[model samples]
Target: MASSQRSRSSTLFCAFLTLLNDRLSESLIFPLLPFLLASFSNDGRIIGLLAGSYALAQFGFTPLIGALSDHYGRKPVIAGCVAGSVLGLGLFALTLSIDWASVAWVSGSSLPLGLLFLGRLIDGVSGGTAATASAVLADITPPERRAKAFGLIGVAFGLGFILGPAMGGLLGRINVMLPLLIAVAIAVLNLLLVVGVLPETHPPQARLPLPRKRDLQPFSPLARVLRDPRVRRLCSAFFLFFLGFSGFTAVLVLYFKQAFDWGPGLAGAAFLVVGVVATVVQGGLIGPLVKRLGEWRLSLAGLGFVIAGCLLIAVAAPATAKVLVFSGVALLALGTGLVTPCLRALVSRRLNDAGQGAALGSLQGLQSLAGFIGPPLAGLVYETISWKSPFWLGITLMAGVVLLVAGGLPGQAGPRAEVT
Candidate 1:
């Protein structure tokens, strides 16, 4: 039994490393994207479209991937997704190379834009790795320890946010395509780690069969999840929360450029501050807080932090206060760090082992839907109204979400071992 426990611990550690690498690969592009697109057209609308395209593809495919993970297994699905990301990153870098080699060709035609979109679309379609990773955690962890387990994933994200954008920004200063190539390399490394070190957590007896034609409908998993009132309420809250957060993130790099005359490195540095704060909150604070406040209350507190952060950021842009901007981002990160793992723990606690993958997948799908809409809307508002408009909009939507969660969610203390 001691040896078995040691093996499980080792596997979980490997899983954590895999998740960290996966997140790094995903986030490496964000800080560089605004600069990359600006070289093409300097159009915020186009930037928004390119950013949203990834989420649009993710929105369609996340639930499908989640259901597939349930039917097949986590290890294979995760490995496949990482492999896909490697291909997508390679394509993205190739397009950039082509555009640089023949600037006139890029200027004369839409081929570069098409290639960019296609690359992002490919990555987005396989973006279910996070949800699948969560399912693996659920499979391995007991209910009572799940919150802390999820918090560990948040730590991985925090570390990724710190490293990915900062590295991307620093490398982008050298050459824009450097980050893309690096991300591709990281994806390849992640794929190798997943295949070599990660074991299949979901036993064959526990796995679901492949979906039927009707069950495979794009909206079918969503509809099925919505049938449960509790899950539906959580999903609604998740959607609203991300709707605001995603929009803010979508325009953040552009906002930095316009407001402070910053470049990718400065934007990345700001994100690094956020990541540092988030790492502290999610890594150090969540477990004890969940023990005291419960997931629902912690989520409420997180919303409150987010509201303040958004307002501060909106004010900072107009005032050009560097301190206020960083402070606000730190707060935003803190809130998100707390909210994410707690919400996942709450949702996981509400479901049995049988439904973990599907339920979490649906939750992630809602987030992707928010991502799909938020970036485009933010870009439009930024282009037409002001640089600060998206942040203000985020504040308003988050306020509404506060009310939604307060009214709709039940008082669940935390996960219990025998929830089912």
Candidate 2:
């Protein structure tokens, strides 16, 4: 049994590494997105659409992938997704190499732009690996250790953002296509790691039967999830939190560029700051805080911090206050770091092994919905209203999240009682 448990740990570690690589590839594009899109078109709306397109695909497909994972197995789903990512990245690199102006176009964008969108769409569709990974973690971990275990996901994000953006910045200086190619290589490496190191967590006995035609319908899982009051409340709060967070993230690079006249390298450095703060909070502080504060209280406190950070960021543009901006980002990162893992743990605890993948997949689906909506909405606001508008929007949404979480979570138990 001890040896079996050790093997499970090794498998989980491999999953963590795969997640880290995925995040790394994803983050590498964030710092460079504004510049890349600017080369094609100067409109913020177009940029927003490009970003939203990725999330839109993820929002549509992640639940399906998650359900498929539950019906099949973790390893195959993860491997296939990573393989898709590699192809997507390679296609993205190819787009960058093409000269769009040389080709005649009668429509909205050049062929290269269409190819770029296609690549992003492919990547987004396959991005369900994160949800699948979370389900795997849920399968292996008990409720008592879940917050800590889920925090490992945050650790992966932190590490990925820390390294990815910085590397992207440096590589963008050499050539814009270099980062995308590197991301492809990383995806290939991740595929190899999954094939070689990871084992199937979802056994045949544990697998859900293949879905029927109605069950396979696109929105069916979401409808089923919303029907449950507990899940509905949890998912509602999660949606709001993600909406606010996504708005902040979608505009962050643009915010730095507009507010401080920072380039990609400087913008990347700012992301690195966020990653470091998040890493510390999620990797180090979460387990103890969950032990002491309970997921509910911690989630509320996190929302409060996020709200405060948004307010600070909303005002940071007036005076070009670097300290205020960085402080706000740090607070935002810390808050999200605490909230994400705890919320995931809470959601996982609510479900049993059989439904873990679908439940978490639905959770990720909502997050992707937020990602789809938030970036475009924020970009529109930024272009039409003001640079600070998105932050103000974030503040409002996060304030609502605080109320939602406070009222929704159980109030009778203490931290230890609730979690352990």
Candidate 3:
């Protein structure tokens, strides 16, 4: 029994590091995008394209990665993806090392920019790190404990998001390539860890290989999974929840900059507060909260907090109240911390072991989809309406998400909750 527990602990630690490495790759590069692109083109539109490409690639590839993990095994897929991440980051760093404009033969900013897109695409496709890590957690943990377990992902996510930019901002001062180099080193470490230390949680007895090549098609797998009525409803709430959350965050920095005249230093600091609150809540508080409130009630309660937080931010924009902005963002962080893990737990609790990777992969896919669409749509409204428009839009969308989660969930909760 002691050995079993130790193994689980070891697996969880490895999974945590894997997820942290995945998240840091993106977040570490996020703030540096403008600086990285400034040499080629300072067009604001180019930044959006560069940023959006990552989500687009993740949307298309993560489900495939998840299914592959189910078939081949978690360790290999994770290692390969992490290797891909290292390659991606290394390529980006290499591009930054050379001055693209001086090389005459490199026509129309094709080489550097093309490689940048390729790198993000590779990393984004490799974004299955979180989905597969969740699968490994499911493989080991009991259902009752899974929600609390998923809090590890949130903690890793918060830490990576906060620490990445902090490191980027500081390292970028010495050299632009420093953070990318750091990310490369981290990815290499993850690859080595997965290859050497992480055990195969999904043994041969548990493996489910897809019979046909078409089974690997990302959307088809998604369609097949969501065909389950109960899973479909839960997934809807998940999608809507993220749609609003991503929508607001997509425009958040713009709101901070245009509305409040804040620089990246102040804006990044604001995110730091958000990360701290999220880490504390998801890390320290979720286990007990999930135990007492249960996943259902906890998810709804978290949604309530998110709604209130969005309202505060919307109000803050017009009032120019720095205190309110900080307060609102902190609330957003807290609510997100609660909602993310709980909702994930709820979906996880519904699915059996065999489908964990596929379903969770689908969840990750929806998240990437929401991320891809939310920004452009929110940006459009922000352009047409006002700086505060994304918040208002988010608040409206989030209200609907709350209803979906609250109303739809109870009916779908089967007497014993079996696969349909």
- Index of the highest-lDDT prediction: 1
Models sorted by lDDT, best on top? 1, 2, 3
Q: Tens-digit lDDT track for model 1 on 1-420?
A: 998787688667767876787678767888878777775656667777888898898787776787789989998998888878877878887877664535765466787888888999998888878778878889998999998788767778878988987898789888877888888888887888788878899999999987676766557667777777667777777888898898878888888887778877777778878778887887778878888778877888899999888888888744566788888888899899878877788678778999997888677777777888888888889899988888989998888877766774554433332122
Model 3 C-alpha lDDT per residue in residues 188-267, reported as the tens digit of each score: 88888888878998889899876576766567756766787657777888888887787777667656766776655556
lDDT of 1 at 394: 92
Off by over 4 Å in 3: 1-15, 32-46, 96-98, 104-112, 133-155, 172-177, 192-210, 224-233, 258-261, 290-297, 315-321, 345-361, 383-386, 406-420
Candidate 1 deviant stretches above 4 angstroms: 1-14, 70-75, 100-106, 133-152, 195-207, 224-234, 317-319, 342-360, 408-420
Candidate lDDT values, in order? 0.80, 0.79, 0.76
Candidate 3, lDDT over the whole model: 0.76
Worst 10-residue stretch by lDDT in candidate 1? 411-420
Candidate 2 residue 272 Cα shift, in angstroms, is 0.8
User: Which segments of model 2 are wrong by more than 4 Å?
Assistant: 1-16, 70-75, 104-109, 133-154, 192-208, 344-361, 407-420
What CA RMSD would you report for each candidate?
A: 4.5, 4.1, 4.8
lDDT of 2 by residue, 1-420 (tens): 998978887888887988898799988887888766665765556667778888998877765787789899998999988888888888887777766666667244667678888998998889888878888898888899998788778778878989988888888778766777788888888888889878888889999977676765556766777666556767788888888788767877777776777777777777778888888887678889988778877887888888888888778754666778778888898889888877777777777898776777677677778888888888898899988888888888888877776665543333343455
TM-score for each model: 0.84, 0.83, 0.78
